[model samples]
Target: MIDYGSEIAITGDDPMMDFRADPDLIEFIEKLGRARNHYLSLTRGDFTLLYENEGMAVYTRSYKNETAFIALNNTSEKQEILIPTDKLGSKKQLIGLVNNDLIKEQNGNYPLSINGEESEIYIVRDNHGLKMLNVIVIIAIPIVFLILYFYIWKRGKNNG
Candidate 1:
């Protein structure tokens, strides 16, 4: 958890920004979500973020107004994240999920809002087709089994 008033000097595109957890907010941040990568975008500056493996990079566009942007990626296929509401600044906003399809659901508990919009957004990964298979199993497998059982039982009655 980042403290509400912690003064964090965000500069350049340091990898540390990926999980920019404030020391003062550590206790609070720990309770919310695991710090992955975090960074702030200044409207008038240029920066680059390089991943440890160099496979991922984040480029920023500086504007005259103060705009803060954060990108979170759950390299793992299954992950759960918590966002601490108290640590977020008033001006902090989520630019990506505002009106897009990535948003799965929203809750009122967390201050997970962007650009003055207060709402929680749930993000679901495609899971490389495995997730789809899982869903099919849950719904289709049972129906298929029941149909096969009925078909075999009816055929035996007719034969007898």
Candidate 2:
């Protein structure tokens, strides 16, 4: 959490003006917003605390055909953790939603490294679902076009 002094009021008209003056605070707020949105919007409301040790904690949430894993490090040093794929169910890939990084399952486990006082969120999804969705979209687009084309052609013929 970005700590703003009690003297500084973050609310009112132009609330972000003070926040914008500090570049580090701005970046921290942006990252926090991204992480919050990724967890709240994409994942199911329920979450499980997968692991917690010392100054680090790991949480996981599942939504639809995907699962989200979030790791937070509270210490001043970087931390690494190994998570088994079986704990995340039947997932084929772990894609970082916040940082746009991809981690493939290796030897039945995923190794993650998080910076000090930083949080990372990853989405676990099956490649087959993505491929099938793409195929459905590709076929649906042409069918939609054909339907529109026929409707327009019939309308023009009747008008003529």
Candidate 3:
């Protein structure tokens, strides 16, 4: 067994004295910790390896009817990845979790581009939610009118 206490000073100045009080470094470290926790949580779910190439890896995680896509570019050059929507079980608009950017699907493929040594996390959401809401509203309008019409007719008959 090795003694860990001997490697660090017990009652002296800290070895990293300069960086200990830096606000930006502290904030960056905190953010990095949060990112790491999020990544771990994502990995614990139903994860599927979508693609892996020489310089890139892509995967998807799904939980509770929500799905996310993760892509890592291992090389120093920028890489563009085309993900098939069928692999995700449904075609939807992918939104970047970090930047809130929208990725549209075209020709049954969703394209994602990442920079060197960069990783991107995206949430998959159906873009048709609003359209479905509109359809519900359109269908409800006629039913609401019919109910009002019947109520007024009954009131008129009772009064007359």
Taken over the whole model, the C-alpha lDDT of each candidate is 0.38, 0.73, 0.73
- Overlapping backbone residue pairs in candidate 1 total 12
Model 1 ranges with Cα > 4 A deviation: 1-65, 90-93, 97-160
Q: Tens digits of per-residue lDDT for model 3 on 25-57?
A: 455445544544665436566878999999899
Candidate 1 lands at a TM-score of 0.22
Number of clashing pairs per prediction, in order: 12, 0, 0
| lDDT by residue for model 1 (1-160), tens | 3444333535555655544646754543442342222222332454433122212222333334433333333243322333432323222334443234232222421222233212222222222424777898899989999999999999999999
Q: What does candidate 2's lDDT look like per residue over 9-96, in tens digits?
A: 3566773556335566556567667766655534355678888999999988776555677888999999988888778755467777
Residue 20, model 1, lDDT: 61
- The candidate 3 region of ten consecutive residues with least summed lDDT is 1-10
Q: What lDDT does candidate 1 reach at residue 46?
A: 49
lDDT of 2 at 26: 59
Q: Give residue 36's lDDT in candidate 3 (0 to 100).
A: 49
- Reference-based lDDT, residue 39, model 2: 58
Candidate 2: misplaced stretches above 4 Å? 1-19, 23-28, 31-44, 128-160
Candidate 1 vs candidate 3: the TM-score winner is 3
The lDDT, on a scale of 0 to 1, for candidate 3 is 0.73
